[model samples]
Target: MTNKPAQATLLPDNIAALTAYSSAKSEKISGNTWLNANESPYTKEACIEIRALNRYPDPQPQVVIDAYSTYASVDSDQVIMTRGADEGIELLVRTYCEPAKDRISLFLPTYGMYKVTADTHNVQINSLSQDLLLNGEVKDIINAVSGSKLVFICNPNNPTGAVTSVEKIAELTKSLANKAIVVVDEAYIEFSESYSCALLIKDFDNLVVLRTLSKAFALAGLRTGFMLGAKNTLAPVRKVIAPYPVSTVVAQIAANALCSDAITQMRRQVVILNKAKATLIDWLEQSPAVSKILSGEGNFVTLQLKDKALLTLATNTGLIMRPFKLYNQDNWLRISIGNEQELKSVKDWLNAISAQV
Candidate 1:
C-alpha cells in the first residue's frame, strides 16, 4: 500500500500562506469604551417584517437595487448588492483576475479587505503608495499598474481619512480604459459627499464605485453594500457572485433604510457625528499626548501619539481604540466617533495622560 500524504499537504500553497482578515472584536470583551471598528455609535431601529424564511432570496434583489440606484443616481442595472463592500471586492477579483496570472492593483494604507481578498484568490498584487494617487500623479500610477486586472481606490481613505480628488480618479479611469477595472471604494462617501466618484461611472466603462450602508446608514449588521458602474462592467461580477447574495430579512431592512425618510434621518445623524468628530479633534489638538493629528474625516480621527505607551495606558483603562502602522510609522492610532459620553471618557483619559506629562 502506498503511504498516505499528510492532510495539511492537500491545502494549496496560497491558502496555507494566507492570513485571514483581522476583524474587530465581535464578542464582549473587557472594555467599557469600544471605538476601534469605525462603526457608528448611533443605532437605527429596523422594523423588518418576517416573511419567506424558507425560499432563497433573489441573487440581486430588485428592491435593494432600485433603492440604492435611486439614491446613487444610477440606473437600476448598474447596481449589484453584496454581503458588504467586502464581498464586492471578492466578486470583482474573482471575476476579473485569474489566479497567479492576472493581477490587481491597490494603493497601500487604505482598506485591508482589498489586499485580503486579492490574496485569498491567489491573485498577484501590484502595490503602489497612496501618495501616487493622492499627489495626482495619474500618469505614473497608470504606468505602474499597467495591464492590471483591477485597480482599487479607497476615497476618504480609511485609517487616514485622505480624500482623493474626483479629477484625479477621472484621469486615471480615462487613462487606464480597457486596461484595468478602476474600482473606487466610497465606503465613507457620506462623510465627504463632494469627493465621490460615483458620477464618473457613467463616463467610464472601467470605473466601479463601491458604496456601503454600514458607515452612514448605521446598518453594519445588515451586511449590505452596492457596486455602481456601467451595466456591462458589473455583468461579469454577477456571474461570479453567490446565488443568493442578500438574505430576505437583510433586503427588507436595507430597502427601508434607503428610503427618503431614512436617508434624511441618516444625513441628520451624519451631521451630528461630524460635529462630535470636530469636538474630538479639538480635544486631541489640545492634548499634549497627541504628537500630530493625521486626519479628521469619515467619522473617525487618526493621530500620532507622542508616547506609544499611551496605547497601553488606554487599553489598561478599558478604552479600546485601533492601533495602526502606516509606512512603518508605529505610533499611529485611530479613534472612532462615539456618543457624547464615550467622547467625554476619551477626553478625560487624554486629560489624565496630559496631566501626567
Candidate 2:
C-alpha cells in the first residue's frame, strides 16, 4: 500500500476564525458589464517596452517614485511603492503590531482590509463606530483608540463614500501624536481630491497616507500603490516588505500611468465618471425601490433599497453590485459607476423595477 501524507495541522485561533477577503468575482459569468469593485470604467493604454526580463526589478522603482512624488506633491523619499494599497496595509500591520499583544483600530463601515490585515498578523482589533470619527471630538477619538498602534481612516470611505474633513483628520493626528500611527487610506481620493489628508503628512510625523493606481489611474492589473509619509514612518515598514515587491512590468506600466499626459487623461476620466455618477444618483433618487441615497462622492453610489429582493433581481439580470449590511441594516447596495452603456442598462433595470411597484 502507498504511504499516505500526514494530516495538515490546524490553523491558529486568530486565522481559524477569519474569513478570506471576498473580492469581486474575476471570472466572466455570462455578463460583460463589471462594476462591483470600484474600478475605473475607462482604460488608458500605455506603450510598454519590455526589457531586462532576466534582471530583478528595484524593490522601490525610482521612475514610479519620481513620477508619483511629483504628482502627489511630495518629496521622493516620502513615497514607498507596494504591490497595491492592500499590501501597504499588510506591511503597516506587520511592522507595527505585535502578535497577540498590540492592537489596531479603525472606524467601521470603512475598508474591511484594516481589520482583516490586523487579524492575519494575530493582532487584536479595536473597531470603533464611524460616528466616533465623524462626529466625535479629537480627544474623544483619541480616547476611543487609546491603546491601538495604528489607526486606519478610509476617507471618501469605501462602500459609503463619506469623506471626513481634512481638518478633523489633521486634528486627530495631532492629538494622537506619539500614541499611534494614523494611516489614511486614500484609495478613492482621485475622485475627491480636495478632501485628501496627504498634505498633512509633512506636519505630522505619525501620519501616513495610502494611495493606489488601481482606481483612478485605471491600472488595476498593474497592482501599484504608494505609502506616503515622513521617511522615519516608512523606514520600519521597508525592513518588513518583500525585497522586490513590484515586478518589472508593473513598474514600467505604473511609471507610464503617472506621467504628466496620463495624469491629464485620468483627470478627464474622473470628470466623466463624476457626471455618470450624478446621473445614476438622479435615477436612484427617483426610484421607488431605493429607500435612501447614502452616498455618491466617490466612483460608486451606495443606497438603501426599499426591498432587499431588488438585489437578487439585479443579479438575475446579469448586473453585479456590491452588497452590504452596514449599521444593522441588510438592504444596502453599492453600485460602481460604469461606462455609458453599462449605466444605461442599470437605469433600464431600475426603471422596469420601478414600474412594477
Candidate 3:
C-alpha cells in the first residue's frame, strides 16, 4: 500500500478557482442597522401550519404557481417555481449550456449570480462590453450574441440600479433568435416603472423573466422565486430542478402572501420605499462626501463616495451597507432603501460623521 501526494489536481481547475458568493451576514457581521442585500425592511408574518412534515413537497406547488402567475399576469404553465431566483439561474445553465462546450453572456456590473452559476457548471462565460449606465443598447447585446447559448440581463440592475426598457429587451430577444436565450431577471420589477417582460413570453420564445418574493413582497427569509417562460421552453429546466424544490411550509407562506390584501399591503410598502429611494438620492446628491451617484429604478442606490473612510465609519458605528470593487469601481457603495427609521439613522450618521470631518 502506497500513499500518493495530495495535489489540487483532484478538483477541477475551474472549481478550484471559484470564489462563492459572500455577503456581510455570511461573514458573521450582525449590525444593528442593516441596509445591504436590497431586502425589504418590512417582515411578513408567516402562516406556516403544515400538518404533513413527514411527506415530500410537491415538485410544482399549484397554489404557489397559481398565486405567482396571477401576480405576474401570466399562465401557470409559464411559471416554474424554484428555491430562489438564484436556482433558476443554475437551472438555465444546466439545462441549456453544455459543460466546456456552450457559452453564456452576461453584462458587466450586474448581478453576480449569472456568472457564478455558469462557472459552477463549467460553462464558458462571455463578457458583453457595455457601459454600466448607458449599456442597454440592443446592438451591443446583439453583437455579443455570437458563440453564446444564454444571455442574462438584470433589470433595474443590481448594484448599479440601471434599467433596460421592455421594448429594448423584447427587441434584443427578437434580434438574437436561436442565437441565445435572453434571461431578464426582474427581481426588483415591483419597484420599477417598467412593466414585467413576462407579458412578452407569448410573443418571443427566447425570453425568460425571473421574479422573486424576496424584494417587494418582503419575503427574503422564505426563499421563493419563479421563472416565467413558455412551458415548452422551461420543460428542460424543470427536469434539471429538484423533484421537491420547495418545502410545504414555504409554499403555504408564499401562497398566503400573494392574497389580495397581502398584495395591497406589499404595494403600499413599495410606495413607501420608493419615497425613501427618492429621498436618499436627493440627499446623496447634496452630500459633500458623495462624488457621484448612479441612480436607477431599483430599491437601492449606488454611490461613488468621495471618501472611502465614510464606509468604514458607517460600519464602525453599527451601520452596514454593501461596498463594491466590482467592474473596477472600488469606491462604490450600495445602500438598500430601508424603512423610514432605518434610513433616518443612516442620514443621522452621515450628518454626524460629515460635520466632524
Candidate 4:
C-alpha cells in the first residue's frame, strides 16, 4: 500500500456524511436466539421453484403485489415491491429529492437511514429538536421546513416504539398536499394499534406508505420491501430503478408467503408477540432503575434507565441491545420483542441488576 497522502482539495465536501452509515454488527453467541434487529425467528411460507430463477423477476413483482393486495387490501396498481422498506426509502429520495433544489424533513431519534439517504445526495435536512417527540414539534416541523419536498414519519417509530394517531397523520397529509410528499413508514405497524397507511394512498396523492415483509412476516432474509402510493408518485421512482429490481426467488417466495393460510399464521403470531411484549413491558416497569418505557406498540421496547452503566451490563451478558446515540440519551436502550425465552433473559438481566443495587 502506498503511504502517499492524497491532495486535500480532491476530498469531496459532503463525502463525510455519505460515509457515516454503518451496518449493524452481528455476534454468533451460542444459545443466543437473535432479536436485535426486530426479525421474527420463524420461517415464512415458501415455494419459490428453481426453474423460475432462469427468468428475470418482475420489476415490480405481481405475485408479491397480489399477495400484499389481499393481505393489506389495497389495489395491486398502488404497490411497488422493493428489496425491503429500506429500498423503498431510497427510491423515494432518488425519485423526488434532487440534491440542491430540494430538501427532506424527518422527526427523530427515529430511523437513521432516512437522513442517511438524503445526505447521500447532498439533500438539505430538516430535523426535529431533542424535545420534538414530547412536544407538538410536528407542528413546528411543518411551519419551519417550508417548501420541503419530502417528509418521513415512522409510525410506532423505531427505538422509541411510540405511535402517532391516524387522525393527526391525515391532518398533516391534507395540509402538505402538493406542497410535500409525506412518507409513512409502517415497517412495525403489524404490531401496532394503527393499520397500514396504504389505505391513505387512495385518498391522498401526496402520501407514500412504506411496508416490509421483514418484521411481521419473518421475511427479513428475503430482502423484500414495498411502497404504496398512487401511480404518479411511483412513475419517477420507476425511471431510476433497475430493470430486475426484485429477483425471481424473492417474488415466488413472497407470493407463497402471501397465501391465505400464511396471512392467518401471521395474525395468530401477532397475538403471541403482543403477549410477549406486554410481559416484558410489565417486568421492565417494575424496576425503579427503569424510569420510562415508551408506549411499546411495535415489535420492540425502549427503556430509560437510571444507571447508564446498565447498558454495558445488558450487552456483556450476551444480549446485543441497541443503545440509542442519536439524541445522546446515554441512559436509554432498545430491546427487540423476542420469543418467550429471549424476553425471559432480558427480565433476568434486569432482575440481577436490581438485586446488585
RMSD of every candidate to native, in Å, equals 1.9, 2.4, 2.0, 2.8
- Each model's TM-score, in the order given? 0.96, 0.96, 0.95, 0.91
lDDT by candidate, in order shown: 0.87, 0.87, 0.85, 0.78
Better of 2 and 4 by TM-score: 2
lDDT of 4 by residue, 1-357 (tens): 755457545665676437565544443443354557787856754654787667776787776788897777688888888888988989899889887778988877778888888887778888864245335655765696578888888887887776777876777788888899989999998887355676778899999999998888888888888888888887788888878888888888888878898878988888898888888888988876787888557888888888878766666767677666635667777778787877777887888888765
* lDDT of model 3, residue 295: 88
> Residue 331 CA error for candidate 2 (Å)?
1.7
Which candidate do you rate higher for lDDT, 1 or 4?
Answer: 1
Residue-level lDDT tens digits of model 3 in 1-357: 766456664878788888887754687775888998888999878757768989998889898899889988899999999888988898999999999899988778778888888878899988864472255456765775677998888887887777777888888889988788899899999998465788899998888999898999998888899999988899888778988999999889989999999999999999999999999988887788888888888789988877777788788877889887855768888999998889988898768666755
lDDT tens readout by residue for model 2, 13-88: 7777877777776444555567788888787677766768789888889988999999998999999999899999
Q: Model 3, residue 177: displacement in angstroms?
A: 1.5
Q: Please, what are the lDDT tens digits per residue for candidate 1 over residues 58-102?
A: 777898889889999889999989888988898899898899898
Off by over 4 Å in 1: 1-5, 26-28
Candidate 2 has a TM-score of 0.96
Supply candidate 2's per-residue lDDT for 236. Answer: 95
